[model samples]
Target: MTQMTRALMTAIGATLDLGCDAIPSPGPGEVLIRVAVCGVCHSDVHIVDGDWGAPPMMPLIPGHEVVGEVIGLGAGVTAPAIGTTVGVAWNGGACGHCRACLEGEETICAQSEGTGYSRPGGYADHIVARAAFVVVLPRDIDAARFAPVLCAGVTTYRGLKRAALKPGAHVAIIGCGGLGQMAVQYCRAMGFRPIAVDLDPGKLELATRLGAVATVQADETDVPQKLRDIAGEAGLRAAVVVAPAPSAFTQAIAAISPGGAVIFIALPAKTRDYLPISISDMANHEKRLIGSNVGTRVDLLEAVELALTAGILADIETLPLQNANEALDRLRQGRVPGRLVLTMA
Candidate 1:
């Protein structure tokens, strides 16, 4: 590896620039990963575009879904030995004293620090991650595919768990993008009938190929009634909304059955602008509206286990680290088909 590492920075005012910086040493309770691949996710775009209000940490190395080998460890580090492969996710570190963390909701800890947002992330050749926040993985797993399991996998998995759908129940996955695609696969793995709903024909087709029992073209068909018809006696047990659009949430809600849940995983830039919920409908049906952030360490373990055991992975394309800005631009413009992975080599 180069002495001066390469990093992509989200510069002031949301512009991205690449530069060389001195490699950082791990702090106490931290581990330094020799980053093999960094999975570029929509959340990075949001951070670059100033979507989550002000930047949590300015001029950031914006990447969170990280997979690499542990080459260095800080004081008190034991497991995830040097040369071991691991993944760093969205939640970088959390304050264990917070109520949320105490209750095992580390993802929602008041002092939770985001990987790319609050600290340097895997856009570089080497990144320092909190040992408690990283996931130990098998050395032989596919780097490109497993990298996405750090973020997209765990997020959707937590969304499914929020739904609490029973086996053989009918579930709806809204939007067939990176997150939605994984949601459909997980839905099928959990023994549920996955009904994929998407505006794009290509995305819907991909969802079908990924084990969705049925598909709904959002631009053409009626979402609620079509879902109800397909669900039959199961009556739409749960709905996982992975689209960043406001309409997706409403459609997911419309498709849900009595006592079912709508688990929201996407954070649309204008999400607060236009969300229409019916109090009467929610009350009458006993439906739930749940918002899921990234997952905890326990959740990450389960997600990776599922990914390793069930052949679940993202459809990936690779880019050199130098093209990080271009990759972010393409993602923002909706040009990339699936997840875009950045290679540190």
Candidate 2:
């Protein structure tokens, strides 16, 4: 058994605590990772504000966009050789016996485990992850640059996949922030012409540069009508809401064309923030409302390949682990441009 000294930053009752601890070796089917960088996701901000019901276990190491080196492997693990660069995401593990898992929809499995939320994750020196769940990354990509791809990238990709839009179809993406930016890039790479919607002009401009053919200012009173005018009477084939606002859901529903799928990948700070969905409207228009979690392990692998092959990457900022609290603060304050990451040096 290998025990190594590690310095970790933990979430303690809405505050961050930096401390030194010893990390244990991996157990069977697990791989020990020497973390190089971990991305700061908006979900981490919500957890800090106690938005997800009861507080998580004290001293929770919160981070899901993890990139690291496979330092040690437990029994029966092969491939992803020791020292391989790999990534872990929001999903940690799932019960393969469940119907959802058996059907390859493990992201929605009843016994699904989340990295930062359900268990200890990145934001530390090392993490022991399920070998089957870790994604092997290209050694050439910088760890900090690709960290967010493990979470934000895969999430939006899966969200778009759920829509199952035809190639080259027009798809509207609401919210042009971290996740939304990735959504725009993925939309283009997947062959969909993306219409970006956001209240922030700067973000909209960024989205346009990233491949969005159209941009809508969300603050406009006639968001739905404006969307229709831009998308035309034929309507959109799909819409993805990456903005963590209930209003974004309502806007997506109203703007969707007939038979369009509205995929939601973001959770608002509170359930109360969710908008009312009229049952009649859904049946009349046949608009599909879809909920997409982070995505399955296979999706994560494909997303990594997409990033490496298509050059779809998020804008990221790197900071030391000690600045974890400051990074969370910036995310909550909406100051971060794309993604903020904590480097474990």
Candidate 3:
């Protein structure tokens, strides 16, 4: 291995530049990984555009859905063998002494380090990660295809779990983009009939191929009524809103049946849009509105296992590391059908 590595970095907001750099060695309790592939996520766009606070550090390498092989292990790290394939996700490491960590809710650790945001992420040939936060990928799964599962897959999986859908439940997934596509597949695997909602017919068709029982065009007249009709007597047992649009959240609430739950999984730039539900309305209907972030380590491991067993793979367009900016633009404009993955190999 070379003593130095070249990495594509965002030196300033909205600009990606390449430079040669010395590879960082693993610190105590850390593991050095040779990055194979990294998926471009919406959060990466937020970082590049300075949407989520300021850039954590200058010359940031923005990528969280990372899949790689362990090349070196730091002192006191013992579990992951060198050369074993593993995945590094957004939650880099958490303070295990925090109450959240002690309760097994480490995803909300008060002092958690976010991958790519708080630390150097996987947009380079080699990246260092804490061994405790890395997930070992299954041998049968391809590394590239498994990358997005670290973020998008786990986010949707945890959102659905929080919704608490039972078998044969009616579920609606808004926005047939990257996250929505995965939600459709997961809903099917979990024994729910998935209704995919989107403004684009092309994405709806893709969702159907991914096992959606029905698709509703968001721009259609009376779209909420249409969804309610399709859901029939059972109505929507739960609706997972993967789209960041505020209107989608309002419509999702309207589409649910009595005693149903609405889970918002995406974070929008604008936070002012409100879903107005009277206190009496919520109490009488037993409706719930909640937000879910990414999943925990156990959730991520289960998602990876499900991906390996069910052949659940993200529909991705592979791009070179240099085209990361272009990919981000496409994603921001909603021009990309699914997740875009950057290859550093």
Question: Candidate 1: misplaced stretches above 4 Å?
Answer: 10-13
Q: After superposition, how far is residue 58 of candidate 1 from its true place, in Å?
A: 1.8
lDDT of 3 by residue, 1-345 (tens): 565343445554556665657889899999999988889899888788777667767677778999988999999999699988899998898899989999988888888888888889887778999999999986556777779889999888888888887799888899989899988888887788999999899999999999999989889998778888998987889889988878888888888888888989877885554656678867889998867778788888888778777878999989877677788888878898988998874
lDDT of 1 by residue, 33-151 (tens): 88999999998888877777666786788899999999999999987789998999998999998889899999888889999989888888989999988898888989998888899
Model 2 scores a C-alpha lDDT of 0.84
Model 1 Cα displacement at 187 (Å)?
A: 1.1
The stretch of ten residues in a row with the least summed lDDT in candidate 1 is 4-13
Clashes of each: 0, 0, 0
Global local distance difference test of model 3: 0.84
* Alpha carbon lDDT of each predicted model: 0.86, 0.84, 0.84
Highest TM-score among the candidates is held by which one? 1
Provide the TM-score for each candidate, comma-separated. Answer: 0.97, 0.94, 0.95
Q: Could you tell me which 10 consecutive residues in candidate 2 have the lowest summed lDDT?
A: 4-13
Candidate 3 stretches with Cα past 4 Å from truth are 3-12, 271-274
